[model samples]
Each structure stands twice: as C-alpha cells, then as structure tokens.
Target: MSLAAAPFTSLPTPLPAPERTKTRLLELIKRHGPQTAQDLAYKLEVSVPAARRHLCDLQDGGLIESRTERPGGRGRPQHVFALTDQGEASFPKTYSGLCVDVLRHVQQLFGQGAVMQVFDARSAEIAARLQAEVPLSAPLPVRVQAFVRVLCEMGFDAVLEQDGDTWLVSKRNCPNLTVARQFQELCVSELTMYQTLLGVPMTRETRIACGQSTCLYRIGP
Candidate 1:
C-alpha cells in the first residue's frame, strides 16, 4: 500500500451562490425583521429595482409578505417585507426536524450533558461570530441593534425597541423551535449568547418553543 496516497473524506458539495442567496433572503427576513426594498438591495449588493423585483417574486411565490409601514415621518410610506411562515419553512433545517429523537438517543448513549454540550458548542460559535461583528465597547443601543442585525443575518426576524431604560428585543421566528421545545437547553444557550453579545442583562419573556407568538426579551432587567 502506498502510504503517500492517503484517503480523502468527501465533503458535501456546496450549493451555488445564487441558490444559496434564495435561502439567505428568507433567513435575512427571519432574523433582521421586516426590510424595505432598499434595505434588501444594500444587503444583496444589487440594484434597488432588481431587489424589488426579486422580493416581488418571493412574494408571488407566497414566501414573503409586504406591508406598508406606519409612517413615523417624511414622505411616502415605505413597504416593509417580511417572511411568511411558509418562507421561514423554506430555509435549511434538517436537524431540527429530528432533534427530539436525536437528543433522546444521545442521552441514552451518553448523558444529558452531552446534549447540552452540543448546544453550548453551537452557542459559542454564534457568540463568537456576533462578537466579531459588533464590538462590546459600542453604545448599548448600538450593541442591541448590532445583535438584531446579526440575528437577521443568521435567519431570525429580530427587532429592537426602546421603552424608558429598557430595550425590547423580539424575534418573530425560531429556525429550530421544534428542537428548542424538545430541549430547553437550546433556548438557554441562545439566551446566554444574547446576553453575551449585547453585554447587558436580559430576561426572556416569551419563547416560540413555548407557543408564544414571538421570542420577546427585555434588556436591562
């Protein structure tokens, strides 16, 4: 046997960037909250009309919905777009579907700590990504906004609101709500990530895994 001819493990073929972008759009809506055509354009680095046309296509396919924003100020009402439930379903979530069964098996073979260790690893990865994107020294609101932006990028539909000394962070969808419901550890890890990323104490008031309409959090609690 020629030791020099080492066996190579095959890697999963990557999806084309264009195809990836289709799903990415769904994720962007899921995490970033609703976005305008202009916002999508900037994110996609495409022309405004092109982005509008693409969003229209997604809308026509029943993957997205466009609603006129309540005018806070200025000229025409901007049309904000968000993912429909169907759109949220189109994103890649192969693990969540079988999370309960998988975790149960893992617990049988190893221990519950193994399942939690898995969640902790995932949370650490997400936290590191967010930390790199948003500095901890930035102002609190900006950090919150940065966290929301990161959530959007990760495919969450996240928004930030301020009331007095508290900042309300809400996510409209959970990519892995099924797994989160089966294993609350996932939820805990995500909350820990949020606390780390935003650098402020937060309390989770609502959880989609718990049948809430949104995952609502109050910062500075």
Candidate 2:
C-alpha cells in the first residue's frame, strides 16, 4: 500500500453566512496591519459607509481601536482602526508558550542566575531603546510619558495618569504576566528598568502579580 502525504492547512478555518463578512473583515485587517474604513471598504469591495458600519460594530465589541493618523500635507487627519490585543486574540499565537518553555528550560539547565542574567540583559536593551526616545536629560514626567508610550506600543497596555498629587505610570495589562510570575526576577527587572529610565524617586503602588487591579508606579519627588 502507498502512503499519502500530509494535508495542507489554512488559518482560522472558515465560517458561514452573516458571520462570514465580519470574519473576513477582521482577517483583512489582521493581514494588512491597520487600515482605514475606506481602505477596508475597497479591500472588502463594500461601500465606505457599510465598511464604517462594520468597523463601528467591531469597535463596539472591543475588537479594534481607532487612532488618528496625520498624513503628510493632508486635508484632514483621518482615523485608522487597528486590532486591539483582544481583537488579535482571534488569531493564533505560539510565542508566549514557547517563551515560557524556553525560560523554564534555561533555569533548569543552567540556574536561576542564568535566568536573571537573561532578564537583565533584555531590560538593558529595552532601556537603551527607551532612553533614545525619551532622552536621559529630559524631566522625570516627560521621561515617564515616553516610557508609557513605548510600553503600550510593545503591547503592555500601558498608560500614564495623574492621581491627585501623584503621577501614576501603570501597565493596565501585563504582556508577560505568566512568565514574570514564574520567574519573579522579571518583576524585579521591570522595577529596576523604571528607576533606571526615569532617574527619579519611583515606587510601586500596586502590582498585578500581587492581586492589584493595575501595575501602578508613583513617579515624583
């Protein structure tokens, strides 16, 4: 008997009927990074208003977010919508699992020292990139703002907010919470990173790992 070769696979499987339009729209956005309603309309071969309606429905469901884009020599700034972390969840991912496994193996094979070194090295690299954007000579508040933007762009769901007299820098959602919890060193490195980046008196007001709602840091004298 002759053996057959393995079958080819396609992403996300497929859906039928009314779900098809929404699913296809999401997939188009996912494949093309971010796109405006007009662009999405052209891609989907649907009218611009219809595309906007679909996008509105998706945004209402918390699948995407609208960001204002200032084009060069533009008549007006336009809004481009992109998938939020929640929206991206509809897609497949393997990186997080692989990262945890790799770190665990490193700790087991070498030692906790090696794992700490890994985190430290990673933090150092991140700090360098952040410093380039924020500048070390900038004011503490300015530096905190820059770092918050960087964290959000890196999928940390970070934001800087003012709470009464304090400026609070918080990561609303931790991208690597599981790995950080398991390693613990990751958490220490994160605090050290903030201190090194901001060059000001900062304290952790709350931490997600410790059952707090948000991972908050107080930045000021």
What C-alpha lDDT values do all the predictions have?
0.84, 0.84
**lDDT of candidate 2 over 1-221, digit per residue (tens):** 99898897878866774467778789998998778889889988989998888888889999989998766647688889889999999899888778889999999999989998999999999888778887888876677788888888988798878877668888889888778667788988888887888777688878887778799888876
TM-score of candidate 2 versus the correct structure, residues matched by position = 0.60
Off by over 4 Å in 2: 1-90, 163-166
TM-score for each model: 0.58, 0.60
Clashing pairs in 2: none
Tell me, by TM-score, which candidate is best. Answer: 2
> lDDT tens string, model 1, 1-221?
55687799999999986566666677778888888888878898888887777777789999999998755656788889998888877767676667788888988899989998888898998788668777899998778888889888877899989989999988998878778888999999888988888788999999988888999999986
Clashing pairs in 1: 30-156, 30-157, 31-152, 31-156, 31-157, 31-158, 32-152
Residue 104 C-alpha lDDT in model 2 = 92
